[model samples]
Target: MAVYTHVSAEALEALLARYDVGELVSAKGIAEGVENSNYLVDTTRARFILTLYEKRVDAGDLPFFLALLDHLAERGNPVPRAIPDRAGVQVQTVEGRPACLIEFLPGVSLSHPTPRQAASAGRALGAMHAALRDFTPTRPNGLGVDAWRPLLNRCSGDLDQIAPDLFATISAALDDVERDWPRSLPTGTIHADLFPDNVLVRGDSVSGLIDFYFACTDIRAYDLAVTHSAWAFDATGAPVDAGVGANILGGYASAFGLSSEERAALPILARGACIRFLLTRAWDWLNTPADALVTRKDPVAYLRRLEWYRANPGCFA
Candidate 1:
């Protein structure tokens, strides 16, 4: 959710004319995330989101993402559906990039979530996994364990610039994670990047689960691990709030029970989750342009999480 490409008023009006969303009253750029260009669009009919698929997002994968949202919305998951144009086209070309007008779900993204809010988010995630159980479309996890080492290799030159001994430490962690990566587990379509901002809450309940850009076919527990790593930690990567983590697990369990095998694999899966964010953040930190309209996240944050996971393997137990 960043603004790389700027659309002029005339261009925006032309684009809006393709759909029945009415004349554009206002559109503002969203600058929170680093993946795509997003704008909070308002029109005569209603509010909506205009997302321009950025370079990092492969245009070919737009159908999978849009269809996933449709499927989840059909099953009553709190997800936004892509709005189709007058010609019944969901995907459209806007400003020379593939784009979509997304349904604007009503909710606010929480920065510092309470335990009860975390529990609601967990339940939403569990229900999402359940809804996706019968979804047959399969897209492999592009950022899975196998892709970590290569991603790390790309960031090797600038690893130590971010932190001391970061390269060697990440290399060793990758070695261990690859060596013991889970062979078999219950797999399904997962919201691989279930960070705090991706979830929208109305009071204590989840109102929307936005951002399906990173959703893919992966291990079910790994999705939980990603959510745990995201919601259970502070900005400095400290596990200061035990209540949040506990309630998240409890709420998720109440909705979707994890097998004993999945439970046993949590620690390692969490380590893998940490590595995924650490590497991607490092890459973005090193490569993103200084003038880019996006926030550059700290790679050291996830480094701290990796250290905690290593020292406290039984943290999940």
Candidate 2:
């Protein structure tokens, strides 16, 4: 979120006028995410995250995302709530981009989590699943396995530059994931992309989970799969201490228990996690501007994880 769309101070003033959040004393670009443009917005009343929905975020999906945020926050979930404007609207147009002011959540996202930290994140993930149990509306996971193939195809022709046979490797892995992918499993609100960066921690406990842009109704264990690959692996994409993975499993079991079928599907879902990040990394690697402020992560790291999962499918067992 490193200043994708530059909003001047004058533009900020106009945007602030639409909301009752006092004055815009300072606004600085937040250097956290690769999607959406975010600013650390401060007003006379309080601080907030001023987000300008980027092209990657669909305007049609705005209502769902906003409503979900409101729902989670109201349930005492540790998520940022969208601040409604003077007109009682949470979303508006600023600099011709869909924008919203979100209450600033406290705590920092952990880059390298210990086993204890992973346990806290796992409990938080389970709690999130339970808290949203009654959220009536459902949003399908657009980035689920169905969406992986086209993105893989889009990146196929250019993947040779990344590594020999990389495209074929991913294409084959996609086939495996789809073949083994569960047709019927526990489905609910899942933070499909619960990577370490999206999970915030303060002290030994989880402060909250953020970045619900990828939130959708999917297999609950799939969320754990996503988090497993995210939290149980080092930056090198190799599994961390075995205890860390077990710790996550234990924490998740505390609230929403995983069915045996869900446990069995974890391997394939974890592999899907690798595929999801790999395609995006490959696509962004080829497309991101050279001078862009964002860091383009090497796609090979996930490729390593894919290979490891293929060799040792008992990662979550």
Candidate 3:
């Protein structure tokens, strides 16, 4: 998460007063993502994350995210557990915004994940879906097909300005997605943004799965599609290593069954995943000021992958 919301030491200390997480011995702002303001909070007992929810996060959706993390963490997903304050509330207001203290998971996100790492990620991802099968609360995927066009429209001014032919390519892809989007599939809770950085791998297996803010009710296979895009493709949409896709898909299939219909819809779903990231990243890239400390991911990276997906449908075997 980003650090758009500035928390002074006094403000942080005051916020920590509500929780028994020990004194905020120290805090460091995290700059990995663009949604919320996250800080690594250190105390006498353990390390934690102090996330100040930003405008992108809806106030009403906070409980769903926190409860889902707590549910999955208890079910062996290795996710960051939401630490409720002494008052027994998981989320509170800090710096005039909804904030949370999540138990920090250990391990670094892989920059160039190996086939084994990809496989483990897939397995862990599948386990998450399985664990959440009975979680009754639901939240719609705000960035899914219905939001794609509107997001595109918001970023229309910056598409061609960012790169030539970008708008036309994205428009065509969105059209294709809407025209043939799958009507029905296996529905379940999904970590909608399980990118490489969102997963933590210590060795051969995954130590943790972070960032459940985007988690929502969606097709289980669509989660695999997002993972495929995140793990198998490079920034230029070229294959980083052969058989990587098979490794991940194989690992996922080992834990979760994929039907023939799911297999047939993989291409379109992957394309939908591509468009989602492309539009969102482009929006962030264009809107975020250059001087901001947060990392601005290249939207074109997803564009490259989208083009590749369009040209090579059924690439996932």
Candidate 4:
């Protein structure tokens, strides 16, 4: 939510002019994101999310994320459709970073989701996975295994202060997967960060999904694993409520039944998924400047989560 790139009010006004929107009525910062400067823009035409890419987002890969949203919207996914400029291009440079205006989706994210909400989120995620089943466009995984391993090593010295057991367990888990992680497990386009905060809901249904910055090509089962790590776990990484896991998995299964093999891999993948987030948060915590306007999400939160996963390994079953 930091203003990494400076976009003036005049610049925003010009952007509104480019669209059919009559006038820029107002603009305000939307919190909860760390990688980009996002503003909720209100205009005569409609509300939209204007984003200026930051250090975390590679401008080169903007096309895939934007195009993927377009593809999903075209495929009937309840996602925000990117608004194109007068030149008919959905992506363009604004301020300093690659910028795009996305249609503002209605509804709020589940900061404290109930079991039913969790299930509904699962259903929506499954639908999104199915929607992008055959999407073959190429893009590198933003935080692929190789990119991730180095961070783990960098943070190894601090493991004792954080969560020592989880640190060792995660390192071992990653090693195990490196040896036998499947080369093929239904690969395709996936929303790697399908957290509750990224999902918008209206009433009992999921209305839209936002923040495609982490979207990329990866194993479909990995997507499910990421979703499980987000929706099914508590602050301590233990299953939140008795029915949370069942509801989520059940909803996803109804949408696209997981193979027995896929089911077997879920627990391991979930552990790896936890480690991925833990390392990323640690990297950000160590690297992020103290003066940045954005809030640094706690790396220790995921550390505790890893510990809980280690204690209650049966929860993944």
lDDT of 1 by residue, 1-317 (tens): 79889888888899999998889999999999889999999999999999999987899899899889999999999899999998999998889999999999999987788899999988999999889888999998999999999999888868999998899999999999999999799999999999889999999999999998999999999999999999889888988578788777878888888788998999999999999999999998898888888988888999999888899888777
User: Per-residue lDDT for 131-250 in model 2, tens only?
Assistant: 889987888888889999999888877998988988888999999898989889878888888888887788878887788888888888889988888777787788788878888888
Model 3 lDDT tens row, 68-132 = 88798778779887788888988888889998888898899987888998889888887888899
Q: What is the lDDT of candidate 2?
A: 0.84
Off by over 4 Å in 3: none
Clash count list over all predictions: 0, 1, 0, 0
- How would you order the candidates by lDDT, starting with the best? 1, 3, 2, 4
Ranking by TM-score: 1, 3, 2, 4
lDDT on C-alpha atoms for all candidate structures? 0.91, 0.84, 0.86, 0.77
Find the 10 residues in a row with the least total lDDT in model 2: 288-297
lDDT of 4: 0.77
Lowest summed-lDDT stretch of 10 residues in model 1? 240-249
- Least well predicted 10-residue stretch by lDDT in candidate 4: 158-167
Q: How close is candidate 3 to the true structure, as a TM-score?
A: 0.96
Residue 207 lDDT in candidate 3: 96
Is 1 or 2 the stronger prediction by lDDT?
1
